[model samples]
Target: MVTFQFIPFQEIENLGSAKRVNKLLNIVKENKIVLMEGRLKKQEEADLIEITMEEISPKFKGIELSVVYPNKSKQDFGQKVKGTFANLLLGDRQGMTIIGPASVVKRIEQNPNKIELFTKEAKTPPAKRYRKKK
Candidate 1:
């Protein structure tokens, strides 16, 4: 069995509107993988959250966990499924998290034909111009 933590992006509401955008930026820096909904709250607040894996809960049917980066948070009932996640935390700012348990992972792994990765070697850049003298 497996369990997952559900993180919503609207928790920043409590922070007030002025720092909403700033808070979102900070969250991006902290978590490597995150799904952000660009929409702001009524008071104009963005929702940003990070998801991490954990041990399965026998009482729970699917992964249903909630965590607050600072204050407290709560989730609704009956919303957890099983599946696999291949870099579920893709660097994309807007996207839904696909939850899959062991079965899904195994099936994809065993498939003969699979999607190939498309990427090329990255190039390094030179230092920027600077003028600091006395």
Candidate 2:
């Protein structure tokens, strides 16, 4: 069965960058998809990918990550200014981040209107046939 875990920004707001990345990675390693409240800083995102690569193994195939944020191109000047101020004061809590294990999540696609997350189907072992012996 597939599992999803929601992580609020407040939950990791106080954590160091490494801790935050590790926390998310740990969840992903468990084969659960993580829906995070905010996007990580650019550097932190890189670090997460780097760490994931290093941890790739037979049991841990790595992660699929994506971030979705508002598009500012169509926003008015005043709206942009307000958004900047809000980000400055409240941290970068404007977007959503998704992290899932590669073994489960096949891919993640994002567009201005929506996000599509495709997951890999579970592979069940074949049943064994038995015959009576004389």
Best model number under lDDT: 2
**lDDT (C-alpha, whole model) for all candidates:** 0.30, 0.92
Tell me the lDDT of candidate 2: 0.92
Tens-place lDDT per residue, model 1, 5-44, is 3335445435555565455433333322223332343233
Residue 113 local lDDT, model 2? 85
Residue-level error in angstroms, candidate 2, position 119: 0.7
Error of 1 at 2 (Å): 20
Q: Give candidate 1 misplaced runs (Cα > 4 Å).
A: 1-10, 41-134
Best by TM-score: 2
Query: lDDT tens string, model 2, 1-134?
Result: 89999999999989999999999999999889999998899999999989999999999998999998878897899999998998898776778899999999999998888899999988988998899898
Residue 41 lDDT (model 1): 36
Cα RMSD to the true fold for all candidates: 18.9, 2.9
